[model samples]
Target: MAKAFASQGDMTDKQISFTEVGRDLYAFTAEGDPNSGVIIGDDSVMVVEAQATPRLAQKVIDCIRQVTDKPITHLALTHYHAVRVLGASAYGAGQILMSDAARGMVAERGQEDWDSEFQRFPRLFQGHESIPGLTWPTTSFTGRMSVFLGNRRVDLMQLGRAHTAGDIVIHVPDENVMFTGDIVEYHSACYCGDGYFADWGGTLDAIKSYGVDAIAPGRGDALMGQDMVNTAIENTRDFVHSTYRPAARVAARGGTLKDAWDAVRAECDPKFADYAIYEHCLPFNVARAYDEARGIAHPRIWTAERDMQMWDDLQG
Candidate 1:
């Protein structure tokens, strides 16, 4: 049967949870929805990954208020995806931090992504009107930058491109806690519409090298303990391989995009069928994999029109 268009069929509210993963570090997750990570510094606060809208971000702010009254001084955009970065204005942060590459993406296709994602996932874009155009990064860095929140140090590093060319992770060295945006999804599907599948595994390996004690993934629950962290990383890596390997093989034989999609579904469905967003992401994931496997270096822009076209061609 043909599936629902993007996340358009998903309108029910998810249960939100705010769990403290470490000292002054909390994870704000909404079931399978986008997540935000909180870091309470000695004096101020930093938020990682704003939700889809100012209204949704306000819900996160309420959760942050429940924990501490510290002013949110820093807002980090782990990547340029609309669901992750559009709600940035609500934070009222002094510095909006992102990688220089992410800034370039925002300049290149931010508007297209905003429209595509809003149409694709209307439920997440609850307060679409509240967004003040594109959320530009006030401060962007190349390689790595250290943000100090009083005595605490938050390291923002661009290890390697995975979900997007500009993905970065928020690392708290003292606590061995890392908030890996969409680069590392725990019990959730990796939306590879803008991903580099060939490099994603190595990126996962790079993340594993950190020996993280706790991880606040982009979606689902926060991962705690070394075993769980390792499992999450491995699971993500497996998911990447499961999606790309079949598509790559099919593409190698000059197969159609539908063939690649079917191969990926056959390989992944048995293992990841129950994962959140698996159905929503499958087509986009296979298309990108097919492109990368056939040597498309960069992802094509995903406009709303293209989104429906792909869905009709593949999912239908």
Candidate 2:
């Protein structure tokens, strides 16, 4: 069997791919690891997600410097994942933005999450000491917010909850491009440790409704054309369904948590086994799916202790 925390063993460096998905829209992808989006506006720049630490984020800064000298005035978080938001301080952004719901999540369990994530994925948090602390958003919006980089307008919208209750997407209407956080993972395993499976499907539909031509997902490669964008969405939707269906079936049949987990693996592994974080995410994903299948509305906070308990009970 794989190690309890599979990602703890992942330390090989991944080649980063920084590609321009649209006119001024860029995606910084590192193999199948967490991805960040870059938007160069009329005069300033906006970074969609911050990497794991200040040190890790500096690599992104170096990449940005290669293209534009514009100041990174804004850092917008898609959600409250440690690898995604903890690097906010590195940007030195004038404003760090997130949905109001995301900010609330930070207040509720941000510290616990930071501890849990740092333990779960050590490779991503290489420069752990550099994280000054939890990243709290300077500006938060309830529904929608618009930011202007000179004449360019970027819309930040909280369409619906998927990976987390506060997940948001950045839309560039003029370029027909979008930066979806973990809300849309291209070929990566959807880390549903705190996800809402049913709602996530609806959220995917809402993302499609935008009719975006290019998309920068939270993980995997960037989708450049309409066809590839649609495929990524469809594949993500399929992964969600494949994971939840068997687990829900097991739950409905009064099966044990292990039973539900095994059922999910049996159903989903064939298709998603090669995806990034597949093994590392399965236990937590199945646990959450089991809860949601049994009608748990809000996801429970995952502390480092609780994470280990779940891992032992399920994966052990």
Per-residue lDDT over 44-156 for candidate 1, one digit per residue giving the tens place of the 0 to 100 score: 99999989899999999999999899999999989999999989889999999999999999999999999999888899999799898898999999999999999999999
Alpha carbon lDDT of residue 139, candidate 2?
A: 97
Runs in model 1 deviating more than 4 A are 1-3
RMSD of 2: 1.2
lDDT (tens digit, per residue) of candidate 2 on 1-316: 3345888788888999999998888999997788999999999999999998998899899999999999999999999989998988889999999999999999999999999999898989978898999999999998899999988899999999899999999999889999999888877999998999989989999999988999999999999888998899999999888888998999898998999888998999889999988988888999999999999988999999998888888855
**Over all chains combined, what TM-score does candidate 1 have?**
0.98
| Residue pairs in clash, model 2 | none
Query: lDDT per prediction?
Result: 0.93, 0.91
